[model samples]
Target: MALRGTNQEFGRPYNRRIVLETIRLEAPIARGDIARQVGLTVQTVSTIIRELELQGFVMGVREAPKGRGLPRTNLTLNPEGGFAIGLHVTPIGVSAALVNLAGKIVGTRHHPMARVSPEATFPVFQALIAEMQALRPKGRMLGIGVAMPGPSDVDSMSFVGPTTLEGWKGVPVRDRLAEAHVLPVFAGAELGAVALGERLYGVGREFRSFYYIYFGVGLGGAAVQDGTVQRGAHGNAGEIGHLPLVPGGDPCPCGNRGCLERYVSRDALDRRLKAVDPNATIETALTDHAGVVDAWIDEAAPVLRSAIATIENLYDPETIVIGGLASDALLERLLAATEPLMHSVAERSGRTTPRLTLSSDGQDAVLRGAAALAISGALSPRFGLLFAGEEERAERDPIMTGPSRKEVAA
Candidate 1:
């Protein structure tokens, strides 16, 4: 379980991060407004802003004209302050992107992969990193964030499960990448990465609590509450794909019968489509084989609706975002077909945002999320680090003040 710290342990760093996030979310905002939003005194806000400005993390734009003697200066994030490299590795391919501090993709590249082993995948990662290196100098890149299928053991930095990322079990992905690039490396479950990316850059920015339903080759889910992704004790909190929705329907490699993914994932839809028209590709299924697409949607909708209802009842998130590699047309049809969504706690009145929504980033969600993971690590301050610093200080100065121990003893 994660531990919480007192204000004295984490006050300054936490406040600084909050200030930076406030500026990021409300750019061109005034210092006074930021101070109010973050609950920091104006003097402290000014000090943090000055430090951020000197470090190029934020820039002061022109002052807003008002009746005052001196206009309030607006502050915004410096897009060029830092860059993060994001990589999404999947069974089908690998995608790499360079993202700026402001959550914008500066450059992206995709490479198809026929193999999933470390030997074959590491070279592709190296090549992609080399390409992204051209976008910024070495030191400006905060770190590389990798998103891969889970049940990933975040502590081990390896993909677990017999079927997930075959041949990748026990691989020290973060350490290897860090050694090769001589920079920090962060690895996240694919769904968690997608949620993080959305939280930072997409519709998720508007909602502090939401569930992200990621539809890739398989179905996955991630939940964010109070702006923090709920990474369960083992970082496998959102592995919703294995939810046994249909008790005896189909067998999953995870040793579950009728797993949710078996009914709602891309592969599941593709199988239904291929059964209808042997030649149907994802594109063909949407365009040339509308009937097949409709049939798949019909089969997938109830399962999705039930899953959504379960997620809502459990998490009580403000919204549920459906995103991943699924096409917009397919997602629209699925949404439309799933109507009258199952009643849940989300059905309450005065709901500002829709209970169900499509992902704004679409196919690039995981890749962008990988980048956001790196950005979060580089920018966010954690309670553990603050406490550790306090411990180190205590070790250096064991007591407040005193005469020599021998003199006192004498």
Candidate 2:
């Protein structure tokens, strides 16, 4: 006996997406289970599963025995169903990777940027994309996800910060890339991408909420709530580096005094090292100029703890993740130095999660996240449809014939 059709309000496309998301989150499960979890009829789920199978997004793995009934087919996502390219543009270089539907990095390439002008940078991006494409199996390239520095305008696809990439102000990066490659393009800030990547593929899969602190050339952060990165008024929500940590201390380029980045970022460490020994590199300073490193840690750790406590109070994330271009050894030392975390609401008893930890993805978090942005855009349900404009709603509305079980069943 077949079950009834889905309600009219939910629509067919929405129901299909619900089934797909259920399988993605919990795979190798029987079709009956999916129907139950998504609150859809068995016949409806079977139809959707058949369609997904034909489209190569899902496939039946094996038959699971049912008590006193026919064996049920268990389904799982097909990792090779689609692919996405993630490219990150930083002050020093550009990195690109091809990620499959399963969130695996199949190919990667990095190119140094001698100049940040559109003229010079476009070729580098083109070359990296070409290299990644060559490495992946020919399939549907969903889109390209670009991760750029913050203080950016997503609508304009332009960099706005005075200290960010030079000559990139008002540049139409997304449009230019889409035109050049003939593929859809998605753009996000560096920290936003990092947080999204973690949510999809890293420790984020384990926790529903957390704060990501990126330790790159400069400090930055992002807040993830239930697997979605929060993008505030502008596209620049996670500019934690510019947060005022010291009132009457060093002047920051952002016109702020004693900003967090001035004390805790890699650039800050370099500056301190240079002040101590004119010729010390980051590597040498860590090994040779131990006194400077210790001093910097002494000053930076307490402030970082304070910032973590502030994040706990404001955002109340389950855990705080520290990651970026900083070396593993440096990160370890920094995490160690920030020990005995300051008091916060998160310090309550019976807490299963630690207040702070290092990112499992390490330096590749942002690049991986750039790819995730594209993958998520393609597969995730469009909740924005509810708030879509009239034109958008009209364009996206699924065709609704007379609601007949047989018509939908077919």
Candidate 3:
């Protein structure tokens, strides 16, 4: 997902919008079937289908007959319903990509930060945004979504008091990014973003109630209930990183000792790596010490199992999705190591353990999730603009974007 391209805008026609949504949620269905699903007349569906075909938003291919009818044509979302930019900004580096509506990566960009301030790092973000903007079809640059390491407060659009970045505290990410690039901006907890992304595009579609455990620079989880990520009373419902896992192991930045993150987060992993090699980068260390990494996974199993059990006991979600900045390879290893450990525990308890699965998306799951938040927000006409006259507008909940904040919050 390199962000090295020219600035461009992609315009989406109104009819194409409905057609795209139909194909997105229910692909491989006939146009007439889509019309029936959306409750539009078959003639109207045909009209929209033609318009979408012209705009390259929908594609059709002949399929085998299901029964006595003639072979029908199945419709699908084109790989190019314009594209949205997704970014994950971390102390280690920034991962960026231009993702289409069908969830395909068109371009990518990466940059190492090594502990830089927001002001210093904004340039890299700007470059990536500019590149992504250029790559989008004319008028299609809906927005730029940047997912950073958190404890970020979504209500305030700022990083919470304690964070990995020095100057990120209380910095208004949505405002700064909007001003810097002159794009419609929305910001929130990176974990929330990742959870939302999964809810809309990934494992979330299968289960309404599930926990999204984000093991990134820090370990945080988000509780999704009824397709919406629960923000709790103060938008900190899932700060599992600060949860005490080891009472006397090590101090956490959130002023807690032996917190869950202090043991399972990348920062914790780096510290353990340093005891072996004084100078070790995360990517390199994980690559070189494969056996040691497996050992770490083994050590993390109980803690992770406990965390899942805690979430299950509390929320009793259908599934628990593990995802973060860790490589897909590492995720596979962790999944393999976790099964037997959890199964043994399940046997002892005389209960079946809930499903624990790794996120199928790339390392930048949170960033892609952020873009989902913005896209769902922008798609609704009611939330389009609070007032045509003023730029300042009301914020809407990500899941139910069309409703007023009061309604969504309630």
Candidate 4:
């Protein structure tokens, strides 16, 4: 049922991603060894190696001398090949990181984004990018990946939010960044990106279907079905923040009363703690009202259990992960408290309860997810031209390229 495309054809641009993945998982490998490991022919591997070398994306290290006359050429990812700019944009602040191919943060920067629009944040983003660029003069650039507050058009790379990103509503973020930095640009909803990231490199592989709950300044959810995120017909499928759980509660930005976010988000917690400590900082409020936090979780866990049960009844995902600014400690407490609440929900619904787990990916889940989205898109057929050319060969003949098991791996 799948369309046919040769490794040479379908994997031109994808070669980089594949090679990077292979090297990331298995490093200090001979070029021929990597070719074999990745199913690419040695010739194709050589070509990729040469390309990566020219682009400063990969480097060759002379293998230790042995009984062999010539030392084997070992290839590895060049830490300076380029850097990916990851932005976790929130209403309160934007946390940015310069991540290398190995998924390590080489540099980090954070700034308050109050009343800031994309245009307004441009200078901050530019400075951050410049700082990262300065770190590796030999390297060019891959692109910028932004994990923004939802709702977003995945196809259009546009933001559609009820929050604080100014001039962000409908602007093609990719185009703007592409023009500004003269490099590829990618952006997506924080929750969607987190889901993708988890699926590819996090606990996402543990479940065929799972729900990712992101508790930040607001609350958001992402649903993964069959290893792919279900973006819905209008790309707004996972808008769980406005789930009307209360009959007559405080109003939400979505013009809905008793929205789930109003009851469970950090904002909600802050509002509740204001009575105890009117001048409490976000962290202070949380620390000041640990009991209130537990009480709120006691209330929220049932609602969350209901939400999880609904997902199970509808899609039957294997597990649910809680993430975002919600602390791991808080998530542990929430999970423990939700156990009884979930049991209650299961008793009422007469269905087996799905597993509830704290997100292992932590705050970086959404940002890493954005990077995964960019990598996936870059390797897709629609965007193959960026890396692979039309003149690229499909495969090499065994006669011409003897013992090409490595290329076959590619």
* Candidate 3 wrongly placed segments (more than 4 Å): 1-19, 29-51, 65-74, 134-139, 153-163, 180-183, 203-205, 290-295, 335-354, 381-410
lDDT of 1 at 346: 93
lDDT tens digits by residue: candidate 2, 1-410: 12233544445555656777778878888899988877777888888787677656677886656577777678997777667899998877799999877888888888866567778899888988888877653455767899988767432223323235767877888898978875557888888999999888888888889999998777889999877789898878878888898889788776668888888888789889988789887767778998898999999998888788889998999999888887778888888888888888898889988898788888788888999887776555563234233433523422111112222223
Candidates sorted by TM-score, descending order?
2, 1, 3, 4
lDDT of each residue in 1-410, candidate 4, tens digit only: 12223365545665655665566546688877777676778788787677556555566788789985999877776654545667777767667776665555667777876666766777787777777666655444456787777666442223323343545666776677778865557877787888887876677767778878788777778889876798777656776777888788777656668778777777777677776778765554357777778777878776666666665566566667788776677767766765654432224354354477777777777766766665555434445444456334322210111112232222
CA deviation > 4 Å runs, candidate 2: 1-18, 36-41, 63-71, 153-163, 274-292, 383-410
Identify the superior model by TM-score, candidate 1 or candidate 2: 2
lDDT of 1 by residue, 327-397 (tens): 88888889888899999999998888888999999888998899988877755545224424354442222
For candidate 1, report its TM-score. 0.82
- What value does the lDDT take at residue 22 in candidate 1? 73
Q: In terms of TM-score, how similar is model 2 to the real structure?
A: 0.83
Q: Judge candidate 2 against the unseen true structure and give its global Cα lDDT, from 0 to 1.
A: 0.77
> Which digits, one per residue and each the tens of the lDDT, describe model 3 over residues 136-201?
535244456766666554422134323366667767777878787645666666778889889887
Deviation of model 2 at 57, angstroms = 2.2
Model 4 ranges off by over 4 Å? 1-42, 53-82, 153-167, 205-208, 341-354, 379-382, 387-410
* TM-score versus the correct structure, for each prediction: 0.82, 0.83, 0.76, 0.75
